[model samples]
Target: MTKRSEVHWRVSEFESGQPFIVMEQYAGDELDLFKKFIGFDLPDGTSLDEAKQIRDLLSRKLIRVSET
Candidate 1:
């Protein structure tokens, strides 16, 4: 599929662990509408500075932020 979609990340927690969520949503597409977010794990030794950097990187790669 040669389709492109905007994406964003939201910080979320599941149970007692913090997870980063990557969400992708189609803007205007027929018969191919899809929305999903997959959580990422911050493994041991991941520092706050690193997480912040990742967050910033995601922000730069995003088209816009949307609440779900």
Candidate 2:
């Protein structure tokens, strides 16, 4: 009934049906973060909303680093 439960079920289904695709997704996210240092853009499937979410999260950081 909870969202966590739903996500667990979906992950289980994914693991059972096509583990390779899920592995690829995890790898891709890691690669994306690494590529950020070189100014590589987010993947094509990333939406404006997601970009806004990432920007909002990054802007909230209080560390005051110039990397962003």
Candidate 3:
């Protein structure tokens, strides 16, 4: 028996020039997996301060997810 568990994270950009973070989870087999989006869309000319805040939030979410 194989006990498999994994989590994948990625960033994707759309043609409209917005970026979003995607998270995927896998257990046992590729067929048994789930995906979710963080819903933080960054557009062109985003402010540095705002970017920093988003980064912090993303880090927190990543940490929480990794703990599961």
TM-scores, one per candidate: 0.51, 0.34, 0.38
Better of 1 and 3 by TM-score: 1
Model 2, residue 23: displacement in angstroms?
Answer: 30
Clashing pairs in 1: none
Residue pairs with backbone overlap in model 2: none
> Per-residue lDDT tens digits of candidate 2, residues 1-68?
11111000011112223211111121111333233322224444555566555545544542122211
Best-to-worst order by lDDT is 1, 3, 2
TM-score, prediction 1 = 0.51
User: Which has the higher lDDT value, candidate number 1 or candidate number 3?
Assistant: 1
Q: Per-candidate RMSD vs. true structure?
A: 5.9, 16.7, 6.2
Worst 10 residues of 1 by lDDT: 28-37
The regions of model 2 sitting more than 4 angstroms off are 1-40, 66-68
- For model 3 the local lDDT of residue 41 reads 62
Model 3 lDDT tens row, 1-68: 44344544456656665555555553334422343344456768665565566656655565423332
Give the best candidate by lDDT: 1
